[model samples]
Target: MRGLKKEARLPTVYEVIGVLILFIVIMFGFINLLELPIQLALFTSWFMVIGLGLWIGLRYKKLQDGLLQGISNGLEAVLILITVGALIGTWIAGGIVPSIIYYGLSVISPNIFLFATLIICALTSLATGTSFGTAGTAGIAMIGIGQSFGIPLPLVAGAVISGAYVGDKLSPLSDTTVMTASLTKVDIIEHIKSMLYVSGPAFGIASLLFIFVGFFYVGNSVDLTRAEEAMGALQGQFNISWYMLVPPLIVIALLAMKQPSIPTITFGAFLGVIWGFAFQGIPFLDAIQTSYQGYSIDSGIEFMDTLLNSGGMVSMLEVILLILLALGLGGLMEAAGILHVICQTLLKWADNAGKTTLTTLIAAFFGNFFGGAAYVSVITGSKITEENYDRLNIDKRVLSRNTEAGGTITTPMVPWSDGGVFMAVTLGVSTMAYLPFLWFHFLVIIITLLYGFTGKFIWYTKGKEYTENYEDSTVNTTKFEA
Candidate 1:
């Protein structure tokens, strides 16, 4: 397969542009006119786009090998998502989720509303290592509380999304983070450290915004009856105890140890099943069923039931389906050299190192926009940007970091991307509605571009050499430079 890397002729600039326009039209129809489920739309796009990509590949005659390689590359991510679904399902059923709510509600107050939102969403996103999961689960819970308090739903949703992305960007366990580092071949730890330049400032600004927003926002007093009823329902449904906390703690421990995500999530899922039987008095078969089908507890209180009863692999089917379709499309694109053609065309216009960096970043952004998945963005961006990086004498880590900062972090802002779809669905707001409000995502993109142009805080080795033990030795000399 490696031998297939011969210099295949690229499509003309017009052909590349035409393909992009075609992709946009299909996406527009899928989102605006068809109004299909995000996953279904993604799948459909992949089928059509990949077919086109493959047809292009066949002209070069190495398309089959490329498709195989792309699938091979993506296999691990597919497995990881499945495990994540299981882990979350088990964690919820075993009472870890409910336990957090039970304890969290104990300290509930209106004054620190924004701070609380940040903290809760951060913790949940860190635990799940998925901004989407965090938003789907704890975000919903926070929204419920916000509604009860009569806070503006949009503001509450914004806070939840902000905090969730913070964890998604930072968590070593996050798929996008890992995939970013992996595709770029950067040390995961280094990649994270590098991200601080952008993520830290974005987070601080977002936090301050939430704080200021919360200060002027008036919310109703907490309803004691509703809280009490929710608490009672939880107590009756599960043996909600501190012991239920073990599964989440274990997940964190595994992540901190830098264990692979699939195994870590799988372990957590198994532990969840054990907890379900031991504490919740869930029958073994029923527990299995619930774990797969998402258990629903019919506690008398509407909000209480809404909070307590979720855990099931079945719930993630839509996501799985979408991924499969998207992967298929990605496979086809790789086979057809459609992405390569686009990259080569873009590179022709890049005149300087800074311009090259900026171009690569733009390419990544468009990759996410076109591909509709963060993983696709990183993988495609990394493959395409490496030549530009080498030509510019930039560090591979720079390329990798740019891939993430440009592709992964910006995904939620694109309405058709995986993160955007989930955010919109979870928050009950269109991606376009909240796109302007996602200052963090936009900030990361702009900061990445600025840093690329100025070389501010950009570290690298000075020579054009590749080695397994490469490290950044260049210091920031810009402080005194003209």
Candidate 2:
């Protein structure tokens, strides 16, 4: 809708495919061969999209409009990212995050350590509705504890990522979950309930795998000396009190009550500042500064310093820029009619519900690969597949779940993708090193695909017809006829 040229010709599916392959090749060359940053690679790819649009005869004005529209769609998400970064900084400075790490370390033993890590990170991410925040906070502590227990960092990173993403997929506060629901016109709660069909089983299996793997490492002699030292450093740095948890609890309570994300997270950050002042004896000026510039702890231990020195609005600028660039590329592709061509070709094969779901899954995966962002995939994939879902009598919740199943889960697997790069950089682990250990990632995809082929857990509508009603120039609504 953003880029419509009445006289412009649409590209053929084959032509679009050619352009896609070329784009992938260029991205690979930049990222793998030249070792460019993912942001730079994406920026370069944006130029490619622009060139293709121009060569295909798309007007510059239309392309510009499309790019602006795409960037505008992500403005809200960008603001949330910045706020989450600030929350992380304030929480760390307030001793909230450290308290979690400190208390979490106390009960976890080598035997059930990996399993406990998965559960703890999962709950934290679910409560916070942020995988990145969970990883940067609780996940960091788990890594330290795992290292102290002689567990491989790669394995720990994998479990942490797996748990973090599980919540990111299911939590109502998650941006991806919200985006999927909004795009598909499903109630957010219903969308979350629908995901439970797939996520519930996947998480159970993943938890069991971690437990089984933990058995082999149980009772292994570990040097608790390093862990004790790290704990001491944490205790000495900030006031270690149970009251530190009040801030995150406030956040969870607000989210459970269905408060909007921006205000909810902002309130949480403010509570962190209050706690920092009241309990941690942090100066008012310092607390305010940390909200913008991030928390800093010079612990002398490089690992502890690395883990503690994070957060603030400034920390998220790179990710924000990456989202904008990726969306800009998506806009150009849409303007040139490349995405329309591809979607139309894919729809040609969707004769039934199962095939349509599978087509959607495939489209979302490729969309993340091409678009370089999960939200971009959701927007494009949902728009392209909505009519198909309607014609097949499938519930929109199914489409929303599949969009997350394919787009959200697949983003962190693609090495050059925004999610992947952010995870790798944040966790201090290579993407390749942690890839094999992400059981939830692999399981979610496999289970979703299995459900698609078997028609298991696919919801269907009964005796209801969907009708679009346009009441005025500014008001359009969908009506359900029973």
Backbone Cα, N, C clashes tallied per candidate: 1, 0
Show where candidate 1 strays beyond 4 Å.
Answer: 1-9, 37-72, 120-161, 164-168, 171-190, 218-229, 395-397, 414-437, 459-482
- Across 368-449, the per-residue lDDT of candidate 2 in tens digits comes to 7666677777866687777788777888889998888888888888765567756776676888899999999888888887
Predicted model with the maximum lDDT: 2
In Å, residue 194's CA in model 1 sits off its true spot by 2.6
Query: Clash pairs of candidate 1?
Result: 57-336
Q: Give all TM-scores, in the order shown.
A: 0.79, 0.86
Q: State the lDDT at 12 in candidate 2.
A: 63
| Cα lDDT listed for each candidate | 0.67, 0.78
The TM-score, computed over Cα atoms with residue i paired to residue i, of candidate 2 is 0.86
- Model 1 residue 27 CA deviation in Å: 2.3
Off by over 4 Å in 2: 1-6, 125-137, 140-144, 147-150, 172-175, 185-190, 218-222, 394-397, 415-418, 430-432, 459-482
- Model 1, span 374-439: residue lDDT tens: 777786667766766665567777787778877777777776556775576545567777776676
